[model samples]
Target: PLMYPCRFNLSTRSIHELAARKAIRSLEGHDLKDVSEYTDHNSEKYKKMVEWIARDLDVSTLRYQTADDMIKAIGRPKENLCLYCWTGECPKSARPKAAITIDIVEVKPDATRTKEIKVEL
Candidate 1:
């Protein structure tokens, strides 16, 4: 649903918009692919990409409320998502982290999904 360091600050709204745009663009054209991956861990090759993201995206408080809006905009196109990006102290970078957790309450096929989701670091 979101990349690593999923936290976002409301101050950087413009940057947040750009990041959402990029995520939407990447997620488009793929069917049945529900996972989002950062795929960049401070690699020499992705340095440019990271720089571009920092320049074009705003994620100061993404995890706050902007992330919810982004996910809402994206909708449920894929079943699961895997986000992988640089997870340390950077600016507006995507990283890999667990988005949601699910526990089986019953062995029924129609078992209910968790009403509240827990994110793990």
Candidate 2:
């Protein structure tokens, strides 16, 4: 199976925390656990994206507050860069699920902005 090494951080906000909590809660009885393989592994692929993220994070002028912050840090708004794809895994394989949840707490795309609401997906 394809594996991803992500750790759950307690410092993130409630929306993201809640989704991870919910996903975790859903797996309450499962034997699943995080499998670590990329131990201190540095490679060209990892370097490429970190550089990309630094650039996009600057261009977006992002100040992140949720999982979306991490997302926008690496991707443009409305762009969903799959976790598997970014890590150089074949996307056709079972996609490793991600715990990062993004809630747009606020956005001012331009000088003229107002309240925006989106239904939960």
Candidate 3:
């Protein structure tokens, strides 16, 4: 079983999709579970993805976590932490700043037609 701290947030979902397509396909049809405590945990899209992937992987069971339960497990005040990953809401004090951008390019394709990733800084 594997546990995901934040399941429903946009960034989390993007990472999961990337993993499903690239990372976890090698271990296909395996039983796995993702534990989360988001209030929107059971929302339609999130639950559907869970069920679909579980079936694709043949997972035996699926479960989720409640916000209170997660808070208790973390043993910290919500204000002291960045809950953006879980709630998709940035703290009031957080401000946006310029970020470095990088680009990825594939070169020298091989047997599987996959090639080395060239990152442009």
RMSD of each: 15.8, 16.6, 13.4
lDDT of 3 by residue, 19-101 (tens): 33222333444424442321255566455545655676687765555445655665555554445444545443333343322
Report residue 38 deviation for candidate 3 (angstroms).
9.6
Each prediction's total of clashing residue pairs, residues at least 3 apart in sequence or on different chains, is: 23, 0, 1
For model 1, where is the 10-residue window of minimal lDDT? 83-92
Query: How far is 63's C-alpha from truth in model 3 (Å)?
Result: 1.5
Report the C-alpha lDDT of model 1 over 84-119, residue by residue, as the tens digit. 212223221223464554221111246523222344
Give the better candidate number (1 or 3) by lDDT: 3
* Candidate 2 lDDT, 1-121, residue by residue in tens: 1123222221233332333223333434332243122211254432333344445446543222333444565453433333331132322222345433332222244542222222222
Per-model TM against the reference: 0.23, 0.21, 0.41
Cα TM-score of candidate 3: 0.41
Model 2: lDDT to the true structure: 0.31
Point out the higher-scoring one by TM-score: 1 or 3: 3
Off by over 4 Å in 2: 1-9, 13-41, 59-121
